[model samples]
Target: MLKQAGANAWFHKGDLRRAQAWYAEALAGMRAHPEFGMEMWKVYKDLGDVFRRKGDNRRAEEMYEAAIQSAYDYYKPFKNRELAKLNCQLGTYALESGDLDRALAFFQEAMIQVFPEFNNADPAANPAPAEVYTESWIMDACAGKGRTLHARYLRTGGEADLTNAARCFDLAIEGVRQLKQSLGNDAAKIYLGDFSHAFFEEAIAVNFLLWEKRKDPVFIEKIFELMEGSKSSTLQNALQLNRAVIFAGVDKDLLRREEFLRVSMAEYQKRVQEERMKGETKDTSQILVYRKKIGDLEREYDQLLQKIGEEDPRFKSAMREVAPVALSDFRHQILGKTDRVLEFFMGKNNLYILSFDRQHADVRALPLASGVYNELFEWLARFQKPEAMNADYADFLQTGHLLFKQLFGDLAFPSDRPLKLLVIPDGIAAILPFEALNLTPPGAPPVFLIERAELRMAYSASVLTQQENWPVKTKEWVHFAPEFRTGVRGLSPLLYSARETEGVYGMTTFSGRSATLPAFLEWAPRCAWIHLSTHARSGGNGVAPHVEFYDSTLYLPGIYALRLSAEMVILSTCESGLGTIEKGEGVMSLARGFSYAGAKSLISSLWEVNEFSTAGIFSGFYQYLKKGKTRAEALRLAKLDYLHSPDRPAFEKTPWYWAGFMLIGVDGPVRHQSPVRAGFYGLCLVLAGVAWVIWRRRRSAGHSSLRRA
Candidate 1:
């Protein structure tokens, strides 16, 4: 027990070498004691984890297999979650190693352990019971089998293999939905959704392949459904829940109960977190107690929410599982006549671009060139180092043009005017600055892609279409600019932010000592637009990404707790748009946190931005917003204005200064004035005009009569 504890301590501290040695010693000690036989599987699993983390894939697989063997040999009933987990691990190993038959066998065994009556011969014919679908192991097993079958289809070009793969993926995706529904908290749901991203990717890939082979619209429809169902789903759910509480007219008592339970759960979670952070000296018993309390609270919360949903049909609809909008409906209802959407899905070796408009839907597959990913990373690195970009301008320009050709050259666009393009990026494509790509001929003067298209991004097509109808706040703008001159928490003072905030008209400003996290939280929800000019740190060194305010830091999890109704959030901070990339879920950035908090649109920076340039650009951005320009157009024009400014040095005109910021989600005007309000204002203006005209006519008549006399 002591040896195992030592192993865990080392593992938690990220000393994998020492952890591996300790685990080995522990395993050897356990093998000598017959009473410890049943517990041997745990040590082996730990060893597997250690090996996996150390990048010893071969050793990791062997350890995982040994864990399964130990479980079967000593455990009374081998059909258990632990055994299922070991088998799934082995299955993933085999799949990655290209041993499809072995991978499928291991996955089948995993399913059998979970269901006990699971038939590998006909998995689709006898699906796991709905209640059992909440076991994430079953979902992983199904995804593994589906991926193995897809691999087989790729090798043999068999339609049967493809069809079976699609079916398995469908079952796996359904399991994902059930699992998410079973969770009581958004954090847990987001974790599960992020973990299950690969399943969605495989599902989309297989269905897209099936569509290519069959040429059926149903397969295409399924592809769109999967895309919408997977991408940024947690953000969508949070928005929906807010809508349910606010607009669905849910009972106040029920809402209060739900809030209490959530808060209680959060307290318990915090306790557990604090205990775990004690490292080698942590109190296991206290941690377990806190976990149990959290679990109890979660169950109670789930029950209360279920009751509320049952009592209110609108709540049920709002909180219900995500359903895919039909392709026809998406095209006709969601897309405008001039709008075009390019949704990219990056598979292991192929990139699929689904392009659609109100009149057309087409999918194109591009086989990736060798080392293309490395090239992309290298290209992005140049943006951070302006010296490198300036040093090799020719190389940079050539590479940029080549990337443009690879990504967009094949697409046909209308030549009448610039395209209103909505981009849905996946994988590494999320960080890509599409606007920075050179679109001109190699020898011709540089013309950027942004010049040819007014571009904005969406998490998914469904998210884009499902616009939340939060009540408009009376206050138009709220700005925060925190001075970090003390250098607390490694943040530097933003010299230009205070001036920048002052430049904006009709905004409630919080600066220096007053720009605290608590103050922002209290007033942010009451405003239609939020602008935060502060320092932000991206996630690293076991710390979550956060924005540093005057008083304290607000982490990503803290951001999730906020209930906001702002139409736009401008994060004029460094790397506010950067975070840990969670496959299908997009970047877990501060910008995404605002989205989860119900902000309709966001303008955030991808990298550490030039504070001076950011201030100038955003000043123009607000002015354009006041002119009622769309968010995407306003951002584009703001960057353009910066580029055209003769006062700026030529060296600063590079994309490194201006291309870091992106506009995400809805691209509508900053404040959408209600039609009724607009009509009333119009009536008042007309009445005032008539009164003036009548007065002018009476004066002219009086003057004419006097002249006649």
Candidate 2:
């Protein structure tokens, strides 16, 4: 126990060397204390964690195997929660090492060990957890099996892989929901931590894979439902500040106390900051005191919220009220002339695209993995950089031509009408600049795909569906262009932001201001549209994206605090739309963040932009919008305007200048209905009502005559 405990302490503190030494000592101790019972098993499991942290996977495998043997030795049946936990750990190891079949077997065995009666009876009959629902080991096991199956599917294109993957994820989700229900209000007392987040992400992802493979809009609808499930599980209000509030039936005093703790936490943070800034004080005692105060307040606040939820069911009902949009409703609302949509759904082994017009929809698969897509994306990302524009153009053009042919060549293009493409990029494809793809022959003058067709982009087809009926109120626009004082360097000033704002101000009723956090939070939600012309700092490898303002930054985690219903949000900053790409979670970009915050349309840059050229494109986009063009069409016309402008330079004509921005979300004519159509609908309804009354009266008169005879 001593050695195992020491190893866990060191591992959590990130001291890998000390952790390894303690784990080694624990292994020796386990041999000496052969009769140590379940404690011996824990030592083996802890050792495995230590080895995994050290990247010695072979040793980790041996440790996991020892843990399983210890579990068998202790329990007669060897079908306990401890055994399940050990098996799940092994499954995780195998999955990480790329042994898909082995991982799936281990996960399946673990699931059976935890819920042996799962196959015999309905899931509702076994609502209670084998150990405790809060442990989440079973959830992890199911998610692991689903992920491994999906991986194998990518390799073999097996329909069974998808079927089993979907089943495993569904079981896990149902189990969670059932457990929550069985617990009732007591469910609020349990916090499963980040495992629940990962579970839902995997669940949504597996269904997305099914949707991509099957091309059934029903699968997409399932995705929407799963997303709603994810949101419903979140106890804090997304629209308001990240705080838990008492529902109608709950005691208001609970909320009042919770609010007080939040205020106290904020005060402690402010005091800590003030103490740190006082350089004269080499004594940081006050900062430590304030930090402890903040921690205490946070714990108290959490407890208060939990109590409120346990006291009333209305809290949960209020949280679950916001559901995801339906697919059928979205399909029926698809109204546009040249609007063609291409939705990319990336699986572990392949990429899928569903292309559709107002009248037709079809699905196609791209036989490319994340590795291949990354290679092509890296090339495109490089080509879009300002410094790379002057380098050898042949390789860039060749790569462009290759990608263009691969992505669009198989799809049937409309022969009669002009094509306005709305590209919904997925996974690595989020970083791809689709408009830059070359459609010209090798060695011919560069002719970009944007020139051949109108192109816009989207976060997801479901997001577009959600925005189908969003009314564009055409209110005043809010523009932001803040100057940097620190943490940003080695870049020329965006003088064009001022020029761009000036042009926009003249065209419409607009309010332009410095991009400060306070000002942004105040103005963003009130306007119909927002355009930020500041800087953005995007993180790689599964980190949240953020936009840097004058005094502070807005991160993905905090974006939900904003209650925005803006028609559009334009992020004119560098890579503002790029985010951490996770296999099952999709891209966590600023564009997605804005969409989640209730923006109907978004314009984001996949890469950095040329300030002057971006200014011109912005002007043209607004001009087209004012003239009643669809959001997608307006962006296309803007890019074309930039490409063909008489005052533009040769470099400006390249896709690098005009293709950085992409429109994502809704795509259709802005002003489709008028007063005449409204009046006609009213008249038709009146006539139908009159005809119904006449038919009912005639039927009644016939019955009366029959009775008289």
Candidate 3:
């Protein structure tokens, strides 16, 4: 194990020579022991990777073949899956080497290994078999086959080949959807989502190529469906399941048991993390125990969900494969006449953008600029270090304008009205600060994208449409602003959070020591609006992102277990909107955590935020909310106010201060019935009741007089 670990460490550091040496040693040692035979395949695979990195294609193929043989000989139970994966790796290698025939054969063999039924099918007749298989490895095989066919089509200009490639992609995506639905927990589903993101991108690209070649609207529609199907699918599934459980009338006891299991799993996960943080002295046995407990709880929870589904057919149907909203339905139901959606899917060769309004939809592909992904990371880093931007304002402006043009230059916006644009970003574009993009030329006075449009973001058009009527349990707001004056848990004091709390009104406030995790759990679900003004850490080193309370921190899993009905959640902390990017799943941030816990909308920071600036911006944000502005408009107005504030220093007015804070999810008004309005309604009801009583008495008296006559 140590040898293998050493090899892995060197491999990640790009020390191919050192990694190869360690892997060779590990392979020799494993070969010596029959007990370690099952693990030999991994050492073989590692050696293959090392050789591949060194560009020793012959040696790499030999190592890969040896790994497959070792898995077949020693790993009997899961040998099929292992074989499929190995075959797919070889297929990729063949494709990269431009051996189209060899690549296609390897990929088909991979698919057959997983689903033996495919062994008899003719590869040329139908690349995607009708038989459904749930294993994720099949997705990889289908993707490999599709890519191979696509390459062949490009070379030979064969229409049949292109059509077969599209079919292969269809099977790949269906496999993804099936695997996601099969998962019992969100964490597993989210992790799985990262693996298949490239498949979706490739699928979309292939479909787009078909659309261009054949001029068929069906191909265009397929691209949109693929985009919507892959984006934020876990979140969409969670939303659907919640709705199904509620509407299916699952028993309260069963629901309670499910929640209990989830909480238990989260607690054990946290315990494992805590134990692992003990470093070299950590108790391995205890960590193992915690893991076992978590696994057991997950299994139990899955069974509970299954039982619920069995009891209510509605739940079972709802939990079936998720279908993305059609493009026409999305435009009609989700987009206003003035609204447009700019959905992006970044492929290996091109960045495809789908622009749609209420009445029109268009798709365009642009060859990706070299190092554009690196440029995005650099831009985000600059936001974290504002002084860098201040030093080269002109360069910053020019670069930002260039990026804006690259991303949005071809789209035509309506001239008569301001646009309400919803941007659905994929891949590295997830963390992009769209509002900061300068729309004007470098020499011209900066006109940011935010100035031309009221901007909001969503995971997908389907998610946006579903959130339109998400239930809000209460009209009340709750605020938690903990002052970490003692540096508990190594956190600095939030000097302005207290001030921020003071400036806000009509909220159930928990400040200082009173703002604990328990308090948050108690009140967060009951309130429609929640504001947590404290410190937070972005996820790293295997730890999930967490928000610090006075007594404890709530990690992502803990947040997921919560059942919140908040219309909006405000995370007034650093990098609350940033986390380890999980390709198709977007950022695994605290913002997403809250979204999983049922928050319809969120206001979170993209970078380390200035406490004072955050306080001022949110004060105005709530004020705008009080005035019945949409959440997007309110946030926009607040940022604009902060940017134009005369009292703020000129340096503070840069995009760094205001642009990092963004609103994601449903951007609608916070509906609160004021005390004055409530009193007026009560008075009107009372007056109407009195008039009814009087009319009833008069009618009775008139009837008595008539009888006497």
Candidate 4:
């Protein structure tokens, strides 16, 4: 038999493509040799890596799954590390496709089969103490999944999404720390990758979270530890210059510009004064020169001369050297903080929130709830000045039709028609006076804007007592269309004295999910940008289940975690985002489940989403999008307005109502199609009419000729 040593040598030599190909060939040749079960499984893993590199997710998942289920198992005592890795991928797809329950099930099932080692703050806390896992493998899963989850959290804004991410980071740090303590003696090399990447990623993730949470710079300081040994790259430069920006927040108490100037100048002055001390006495001319230098130094220390924001040249200089790791880190930084929660008011970046209605007089934290409006403007202002991400910001802004186009492209700002944002009840617009506000669509005018409003039912119809304040007494809410379209409609009536009006389209469906109503079965349609399912959810369980459909689905008939389906799904019913259901079963709630689902995002209700607030939040969200604001921008504005209601300020200010709605599709394109394709047959009718007329003329001429003969 061929020696394992030779095969491993090739793999270690960085000949991945060659090694992978060799492994493939060897496995194919050894297929008849059933005794080489474990070897065959290794080859399959190699193939999975190769396929993954080639951008074939399907093929890679297939190979990995096969290895875990069969080939590796067929061998003597297969490794749990490899199996766990494959299951993670499988769970990703299910999560993305709106089956959050399924996704969790897959992950839990995979973890059970794999006997994974816990590499957290306590390496000794492995659930599977009987069969230990290597640190290398744990790190492998942690690093890869943590990075992916961080991105996911920003897009979706689901607390559950970040839960495991925190776990992974802790495990990574602990695993590494433990390994450092037990190097060579213990089998911890397997987790080296996780150890290497976790600290930095976690620091960035936490910083971004804090910025979103408190909008303070102190949280950013927490990341300095990661730059302890790293060089000045994009991430490093971002971190380096961040000190100035962070200082601005606390600057009220701590002279920010002065501190920077003093520190930088102090170091220079100290060096100069030291040199002067060493040198011998010079001529009067030298004394004059030193006096002139003193004048320059004094001028440099003046705070007035230094630019207040991005105009500071020191920032530019500090960041000129773009570090690759730093750049990647910065990217993560931006990705982590962005939110779709404020999608209710797609206001101008410079536009301030103003409720002329007087009812919102109770508003106080209006500024805080305004989402990213202030932040985006700050960044926009900074972009005008020197910064490495100036180009990146420029590109993003330019991507928009109006402002962005003015800076970058020929595209115009999005039409007045709402941006087609699926507003969730989780936003501030929900708290608005729905009746007072004009929830009507756009009228034909200078701004060709039309807002399509759709409400997401996060909770199921079964248990809605949680929202006792919301009395569903009005038929107007249930009636999506007018009552006139009650029965079957065969024809349209004439505008003058007509018997009936336009009826509801048949394509639209309004039916209960099922009789049993499984507690959770996330079913987000790929075509819909927003999904609304109503169901009760709780977070009191050891096993994390992000989402579920109904009560029955928990553990009885279906037993699934609520999964997500679209960019945003409004869990209007209950605490859908709560981390309920047992771990391994999946997210008992639907929000987290859908984040894993393909929809790319979700918006969930809290303890009990106020029906009035929920309605207003969604109405304004769609209306804002109609005005062409990004999801994050709109949600932010709406939240700001809700925060204006002074009664709820001190305790409830975290734009959770506004920011809770996440953008899952941030990484992917909105899967959609134009009307041209949906109505292809309508165009074909013209061709058919033309053909029929031509045939009639030919037949008439032929008959006339025969009659004449």
Candidate 5:
């Protein structure tokens, strides 16, 4: 304790060298007396901190590694909060070195350690003690993560980075609010500290970046909202509403909830059937009364659920509904055509939109006829395939010109300033690469849509409006390469997958294994980045696709059962992204299941992939990701690399190899392991080597005796 005090005094005085010396002495003293019953992990950590401050990063890392290794060797589990703080320091060191990718990775690792639920696990089942996840620690990690992403966005100009950063800030604020609500005003004050203000400043800065990019007043209003600090209360209310909505659907009486909803639905259906059967004889007043009664019962049922939610603590974070943000109230954010927001909706028969600015909403039918739009997209998907590219290019171009004219004719965007299009596509249009569409006039050279404007996608405008900041974890890769049986129908040898996995694994700390059924089930949840190079066939509605392995098959349903917790999952196989497209649920592909299971991003092929080209392109993608590129940018660069690699023929340069895969989720780089940890593992290898020599000698002696006999 005296040594610790001396180190602290030196650190506070800015005498980093003295602090390091004192910490080293403390560690040595503690190590010398094993019967003292005191742990030296804190001393090691302090030494690491002092070394880091003194600009000796190598020693700092070694000390940090020693802290973890020593604790493990002594059979003492480091408290979760301690682990988080240590990782945060490591991330800070990485940030100082300009290794933004490595920094984000460490920050994410800290976050997951703090909030295990973020890893897609039920916290109750593997609960951390209350002291293990302090409100302050969570806030710091979130703020740190936000700052890292904001820095990355500045460097890369990737909108996703800023958007994700915004989310981190929201989560920090949310954490504070949850603490305050759970512990009451007086008790929660202890946890609040300066985090609220820090979060506010960081949030304002991120919103400023977003506002500058889109020139939207909404972001500006958000900045003001932060200053006022009323948003937290509003968010808490939304949380309550969310709980009400979720609980309403659940039957309180065991199986009764489903039965009750089912009975109500059945009655409504029966009423409709009776009206149809009676035709003119049906009483319109009675039918209206019956509908009113049903509506009243539903309202009452929902109200009861809300009341129950108010009484329960567990349902606090459960979503009740999209925290209500009125579209009319949000109109002030839109200024004019230069900063307009258009949300497109594709129906079975026609297309429509809610195109608006602060002043007015141009809610009307799109001029593009249904038949033409459908036919164009169908051809577009077909044209993107390698085998049909030569024959389909002319068809694609013809349809592309018509699509360009019809889609953009009404929305007159300015040519001088950059147009930031927040696209919300539906139906087949969701997967369509709008940027690649040919926009050149009839009987003119090709000019793609991407050249005209910058595009960002959102599921709904509400997603942006109700966005709350959350912490993200470090990235790690988990790849699966399954061996296939010969003569299996549609099964072909994908030897190049091995090359792709090998190159990607070399770039980062990898958790790769054979695509056996057991291996996939075990590793899928723990890994942050996953790549599966195997045969896949997407199933129809209610039927999920299966990923084949030499030992067994992993069906889509099986994926849902596992906790994913991954940042990205790459399905490097045929038609891996295709699934039954539902109106409200989006596409239900293997990618979708992984997304549901907790994967934040996915790289899936729209069609079959060329094995050799895929290997090279995938390797290039990992290289780009390592350089701090967003998933979309990395994938784009990979395609460009493939295009320029061998100066391939025009037909080969077509969309087949490049455009087949699409990124769907938050684009964050994978986690990187520290060299210190690697060194520790190297020591383990040395011990193994010694054991192997002993075994070899014993075997030689046994062989000599056998020869004598």
Candidate 6:
């Protein structure tokens, strides 16, 4: 056991040589002893950890699996507290192995032992709410199980998985509070604090994923309070990234990603060398992570090579892969993403994209829910490698570039040359610390980086408001060509512009002559991509009219106000995702209106989107539209762009300030064809609703006159 522990310490410090020696000794000792004890488990765990560190996850998984089995056999009969800890470790390990069912089983087993001692009831069947539920241990089980359930939902989309995730989180919360009270040593319990924090974070993430990949600030509001009213960088980064993807906007996060520059390339190499010399190999728990953590170094090396090769353009390579998004003839629909086709690549091939422009230096990892598969990534590399080797590489690269630009449209080519990233939320917009990979790595595709920072927009705004101005900040003479520029007008009383009548639902025929569909509302019949509504924001406050018809009546904070049909509708409203709640009823809001109306999901504001920042946000928002990004991913990206910018005090704030915009109920990998009816009914609904608007206007006039008299 001591030898195994020594090995792990070595591995953790990045001294693979010493670690291997230690493991070899432990392995021999374990084999000779053949005992059912700590020595055996330690040997297996340490061995696996080392292999995984060396980029051998497959072998590591096999070893870990054996360790888990033996540990369980050794501990099952004793029901010891330490056994519970091992169970947690096993559960986490299984998840890393991509064996979700097995992972869930381990977590459940842990929870079973925990229930009576901590929860006072069996959580396997149902969550038992009670004042007696104490022992932070049980609460921890609930959270662990909840995490498993949430991940299962991502993998399978089973309603049971989602519901259980919610239930477990709720139970965990109840148990945590009760435990704190019973223990009478609240502050001293670091375990309780850590458990509470992790559970809360996981719960909020799960809820947001369930409700449609948009972080529900409602859950976060409570979680943030529970953990000593302080903030965790983990939570902040998760949230900021979430906002970025959902919004497709920009901010300091993009430019500050340049912080990777501060990370010395030599320093990275030096650290690797130091680890080797110290006889330790840093264990990232898994080889995948270990490699990814240092992906920048390899990328840097490749870029150096590419920069040298640039002397002769023909000597340079062209690597291209088609359909990372899977917009091929075959169809697999998830979320509402099946409607469009496009992609983005991080390489120096200089794809022809002749039809349009397509290159972004700022890239972030997509969460597990994004419609990309692990296998697909490897497949992409395999395909591109061969493509790069073709005699037609240059021709195909040019043609492919042109085709990509044409297919993706203006969004792909925001400019003819280098893209001018607009900083939002506000900071300098630089390329994502990256250079094309010169070679296809065994795992993820390689790329070089200059710097990486959890991007935050360093914008300038004394106060938040409804209008956003995005004038050209670059000396490069960039301008939105009028024909290519889009002018959108949004109107919905449930949003930022009309809070006095927050829950009110009415009609409008303001488009002129309701007998026939008005020109404004009739556009859906033509070939179009989006249905945007700049409306009011309601919900979040939990105060509303109690009107069943409008979920806004429930008045939860940070939801959109308007619901449009079967197309992509920018609620352009605020806090509509948050629903009004009655004493015993679940929350409801306009999100449902659009869901029922056949709309994919509403891109809405959680809080009021700063009006002054709208134009800039719209730019990225439109880019996503052009790129054919799914509603959710697009909005998330836009929000991220806004939060990471540094142009102004307000321009580069978090989603909380303005990037809280969310796309409700619309995330899947490959976008599907916007249902054909989207063309007809989408336009029809706007036209029909206009009359309702007029009627409401008339009634308002009458009420005003009566009050005056």
Clashes of each: 0, 0, 0, 115, 16, 148
Enumerate residue pairs that collide in model 1.
none
What local lDDT score does residue 704 receive in model 3, on the 0 to 100 scale? 98
> In model 1, where is the ten-residue run with the lowest total lDDT?
671-680
Candidate 3 C-alpha error for residue 404, in Å:
0.7
Please say which candidate is ahead in lDDT: 2 or 4: 2
Model 6, C-alpha of 120: deviation from truth (Å): 14
Best by TM-score: 3
Stretch of 10 with least lDDT, candidate 4? 355-364
| Candidate 6: residue 466 Cα off by (Å) | 34
lDDT of 5 by residue, 554-587 (tens): 6664564454456567888877777765543345
Native-to-model Cα distance after best TM-score fit, residue 34 in candidate 4, in Å: 45
Q: Estimate each model's TM-score.
A: 0.77, 0.68, 0.82, 0.28, 0.47, 0.31
On lDDT, the stronger of 3 and 5 is 3
Tens digit per residue, CA lDDT, model 4, 1-709: 2533445566678666776667766776667777776566666766776666667878877886776666545633544555656656656655555555455555554444454343232211223323434454444344445544555677787655565555555444544444443433111332332235435445345444644566444433333223221111111222233333332243342345554443444344333433443445524455456546645655764334234434555543543433222322322432232211111112112111111111110001123344444343443332222342233533332222132211111212243432222222212223221111122223311111112221222121101111111111111101111111222122221111111111211112222323123211222222344334333444332222222222222321011112222333444444555443221112234454343232233455434443344544555554454455555445544555564567654334222233233332232222232122222444567778999999999999999999999
Query: For residues 611-630, what per-residue lDDT tens digits would candidate 1 score against the true structure?
Result: 89988888887667656777
lDDT of 4 at 61: 76
lDDT of candidate 1 at residue 514, scale 0 to 100: 91
Q: Tell me, by lDDT, which candidate is best.
A: 3
Q: After superposition, how far is residue 81 of candidate 3 from its true place, in Å?
A: 8.3
Q: Write the per-residue lDDT of candidate 3 for residues 221-319, one digit (tens) a residue.
A: 888898887788888877777666555567889888977887898898788777777778999999888888888888888889889888878778877
Order the numbered candidates by lDDT, best leading: 3, 1, 2, 5, 6, 4
What's the C-alpha lDDT at position 146 in model 5?
81
lDDT of each: 0.78, 0.65, 0.81, 0.38, 0.60, 0.40
